[model samples]
Target: MSSPDVPSMTGVHVVVMGVSGSGKSTVAAALAERLTLPFGEGDEFHGERNRALMAAGVPLTDADRAPWLLAVRDWMSAQAPTGSVVACSALRRAYRDVLRGALGDVLFLEVDVPAAVLRARMSARTEHFMPVSLLDSQLATLEPLAADEPGARVDGSASPAAVVEACLAAVRLRCDA
Candidate 1:
C-alpha cells in the first residue's frame, strides 16, 4: 500500500535519520528547502577524532558518538525559534533521546533501505569520509523507531524527490495533528 499523506509543519525541528548511504542528506536538504527551514548536516558536528576514525574505516562506539550527538542536540535546541532540519545517523535510541531532550518538538524522518542498496550507494558515493566497510557496523547499531516513536518511515529506495515528498508529507501531517 502507498504511504499516507502528512500535513505541513509550521515551526518544527525535523531530524532526518538513517545509516550512511541511505540518502539522509539529500532528503533532509529537500525537506529543508520545501519547509523553508534552516538545515544542519550532522556530519559537520563530528569531532576530529570521530572523523579520523570513520575515515580509517572504523565504526564509532556509543562513547565516540556521544559528544557529536550532544553537539547536534545543542544546535537543534538553539534553532528552536526558527525550526530546522538536521541530517543525523541517530543510530541508537539513546542518541535520539538526547536530541529529543534538547529539542522538545523533535520529529524523526527515518530513511529505510536494504543493505545491498546502501552498499551500492556507498560504493558510488565520493568525497565522504564514511566508508562502505563501516556500513555493517552501522546497521548493527541502528535502533529503528518503535511503533510509538514520534516519526515517519520513508522508503529510501525511491528517487530523492520522492523521498523528500514523503518526508514533507509526514512532517505536515504531524504539524497539523
Candidate 2:
C-alpha cells in the first residue's frame, strides 16, 4: 500500500519491535524517512547499567528494562503531536503495554525471524553491544504481540527494502481499518 492510502498521521506514533538482530533499527529508520517522521533508536535510551550488562554478554531482567521502556514511552508521548517511529526490542507484552499507556494510538511493527537466522546475523554483526550468547534469553523472554494487537508482523528473512515495504503495507492496512 502506498503512503497516501494510509491514515495520514495527523499525529500517530509507530514502534518497530523485535529481538536482537531482527532489524528493528534499520526498518524503523527507513519507515521514519518514508513517513516523514522523527526516528528514535530505543537502544539509545538504555541506561549505563543496562548497557554495561549487555556489553558483558549478560541478559537484562525486566527490572533492568523498565526504566528504559518508560523513557522511550515518554519520548513517544512527547512526539505524539508530530508523530515518530521508534525502534525498540519490546520483547514482552508488558513492555508494549507500558508504551501503549503513553501513546494510545501506538502501532507496533514486529520483525519476525528464526533463532538460527538471528544467531547468524548477530555473529556477523560488528560494533553492536548485544552479544550472540544473549539471544537465547531474549527469545525465551519474548511474548509475541497477539493478532488483536494493533500491529503488523514482517518476515525478517527478506531484504531490508522488502521488509520496509511489508511494514508500510501493514501500517496502511491497519490505518485504513
Candidate 3:
C-alpha cells in the first residue's frame, strides 16, 4: 500500500468509528482499498434482535450491543496479524477499548458529520436498518476519542475522495508517530 516514501502499515488495525449516517462504512471501505487491507463491515456483525430494535427506532442499550461489539472486536483481532480496516459505530470509550485492547495497535477514525447532515443522510438511505429517529440517541451516545487514544477525527461531510485523503493522511500521521 505504501511506496518508499510512506511507511507500510505492518501492524495497525484501523477502526472507522462514528454515529450512524456518519459515513463510517464508506470511509472505512475506501481507506481499506487505499491501504490494501481486508475490510470488515461492522453492521454485518449485528444480531437479528439488535437489528430489529434499531429498525423499530429503538436505541440499543450497552447490553444490547455488547455481543455484537465483541464479535467485531474478535474479527479484527483475528485479522490483527495482517491488520485490517473495519467500520463500526464504537460510540463509547468502553466499546472502543473492547476493540483496541485485544489488538496491539488500533487506530480509531471518528468520522464527524453534522447532525443535520446525518439526519439527511439517514433519511435518504433505504438499505440500512438504522432510522433517522435514532440519530439523536446515537449522537448522545458518542464519545470522542481522547488524547491518549490512537486515532484521529475526520470530517465526513466532505466528498468521498476528500474524506479518504484525510483518512489516509491521518493514518500516515498516526502510523508514523
Overall lDDT per candidate, in order of appearance = 0.88, 0.89, 0.89
* lDDT, ranked from best to worst: 2, 3, 1
lDDT of 2 by residue, 33-107 (tens): 888888999999999999999999888988899999999999999898877899999889899999997654899
Give one digit per residue, the lDDT tens place, for model 3 in 1-177: 466544577667899999999998999999898888889999999999999999998999999999998999889888877788999999999999899865658899999999999999888998889989999999899999888888989999999889988999998888877
Worst 10 residues of 2 by lDDT: 1-10
Write down the lDDT that model 2 would get: 0.89
Which candidate, 1 or 3, has the higher lDDT?
A: 3
Shift of residue 110 alpha carbon in model 1, Å: 0.5
Point out the higher-scoring one by TM-score: 1 or 3: 3
The TM-score of candidate 3 is: 0.96
On TM-score, the leading prediction is 3
**Candidate 2, 50: how far from true, in Å?**
0.3
TM-score per candidate: 0.93, 0.95, 0.96
**Pairs with backbone N, CA or C atoms under 3 Å apart (clashes), candidate 2:** none
Candidate 1 vs candidate 2: the TM-score winner is: 2
The clash numbers for all candidates, in the given order, read 5, 0, 0
> Model 1: which ten-residue window has the lowest total lDDT?
1-10
TM-score of 2: 0.95
- Candidate 1 lDDT, 1-177, residue by residue in tens: 112343444346899999999999989988887777789999999999999999999888889998999999999988887788999999888898999976558999999999999999999988999999999999999999877878988999999999998888788778877
